[model samples]
Target: MAVFEGTFAGDVSNLKIAIVIGRFNDLVTDKLISGCQDCLKRHGINIEPNNGQVDYVWVPGSYEIAMVARQLALTGGYNAIICLGAVIRGQTPHFDYVSSEAAKGVAAASFQTGVPVIFGVLTVDTMQQALERAGIKSNLGWNYALNALEMASLMQQIQNTSSSPSAANLPPGNETIALPKVTT
Candidate 1:
């Protein structure tokens, strides 16, 4: 089997990143956003207005992240969008609905806009897990931001690659090969 994936060696200095955060769980989402910003800065990405290396937007809750994300993505100004939110499971069924919908919406936005929408939302059963993932122990938000950078660079590389191979680069008998469309 053949396997292909994005690498972490991509340059993030020139890539524009948007951070969509949820304010409902301000305690947790704040940490997540901090981690994401820290990671981007560590990789030499500027968060200035002119450079446009990073843009930050806050929504009321996780439920609204997708719509705003879709709008920003549609503008075609961002190379990647990172969503950060916390949806801790409670006694009610609200957790399931919010978490699932957020995930689906984020994915849909990415698919429809051809932009990398990295999901850093936490759907944990407890506050501890959410905090841990946010930055207490692992800082998944930072990791997610890095992932977005890698994917953006990878997609750009793939799109720039020729779908059709020249005769010289093709196999012995096959002079040409059909190239699959690499979606942004």
Candidate 2:
């Protein structure tokens, strides 16, 4: 019998990530973005797009994040995509519609593209609540960023491991080849 499992190393220095930010609530979204960047940097991952390590995309609102994320994922330009936004419940039912769609869409993008699409969007009852999560009290963006990195790394590790057969099953010089690297 054989069992396979992955460990959470969380080392993301060698991976690429994307942050899809919504501009509707720029005040809160900006803070979330900052927290995410700081977290990634502390984890030894650079957020400099010029270095081909991280990329950032701005959209009108939460409702628009998934399409852009899907596009980025399809292009194979990122190992993981983090969607950041703040959806504060309003007087109307607009909040419910938008928030649910955003979550559903982002999830769909992940499923359709086979890429890790991290949902960092915040759906809160008030502006204060959104601020609290963004940075005031608990910085969830930091956690989301870390999660994306961990998931991407783990997935890659699993793919690498499964490509090779056990030592006893090898025949001649034929060896397993690793998956192709994603191109920008």
Q: Residues 1-184, candidate 1, lDDT per residue (tens digit)?
A: 2244676664555677889999998899989878887888877788664665788899999999999999988887887899999999999999999999999999999888878898888999999999889878988878988888787776665544435344347557844322223222
Q: Which ten residues in a row have the lowest lDDT in candidate 2?
A: 1-10
Model 2, range 32-94, lDDT digits (tens) per residue?
A: 998999988887887787887988899999999999999998887787899999999999999
TM-score of 1: 0.83
Q: Report the number of the highest-TM-score candidate.
A: 2
* TM-scores, one per candidate: 0.83, 0.86
**Whole-model lDDT for model 2 versus the true structure?**
0.85
- Measured by TM-score, how close is model 2 to the native structure? 0.86
